[model samples]
Target: MSKFLLSALFGAAVALSSSAFAADQTLAEFHADMGGCESCHADGASASADGAFEFEQCQSCHGSLAEMDDKHKAHDGMMMCQDCHVTHEMNVGQKPTCDACHDDGRQ
Candidate 1:
């Protein structure tokens, strides 16, 4: 391929890669951008605390679900929220995934 053509192809590849990265958002930023989960998990039976149990606040206590603990080194943080506790509708015995997040007892 000619140098000019090669350069154009490389540039296009770089642009696409950068765009993909830009689309990715950090967990904290995701929650901040959403302006809290009250929209879906708010009011009546689905009411969540104003400041408590928000995704951001949960991260503070739970830490990222994908991190190292005493027993396990890698956990799936991406699915932590769904893995534990039912949001919007409370069940009588709903418990957070202690073992799933912790993988051991350290967390």
Candidate 2:
């Protein structure tokens, strides 16, 4: 193959590889890459009295539970995004499990 073709292939491979590992990055790391805590929080880096501010920020980017698929719509108003997301304790692409709240074994 030509040098140019080899370089392009190498670049694509590297990009794909990086994405493969991005799912393992912490939520903090992923958000920091996009902007920072402020992207998900208000000024002073403190959560609002009822965490409404942070929740709004999340919906601003991720959409409301009602707007999501059936699984998410089911818990629309029953819980806050943080209740399951728990950014500090969750990874970027990790799906929250239902086993925590339901013992019947559901993902």
Report the C-alpha lDDT of model 1 over 1-107, residue by residue, as the tens digit.
45874575577558656764333444333333443444233441243544344545455444555554533234453444533544433342344546654567754
Best by TM-score: 2
Model 2 regions more than 4 Å off: 1-18
True-structure RMSD for candidate 1 = 15.2
lDDT of 1 at 75: 42
* Residue-level error in angstroms, candidate 1, position 94: 2.1
RMSD of each: 15.2, 9.0
Clashing pairs in 1: 66-77
lDDT, each prediction: 0.45, 0.77
TM-score (all chains, Cα) for each model: 0.26, 0.73
Runs of candidate 1 with Cα error greater than 4 angstroms are 1-53, 67-75, 96-107
Residue-level lDDT of model 2, residues 1-107, one tens digit each, is 45874575577558757766577777766675655678777883766788888888788666899999988999999888888888777997688889879898766
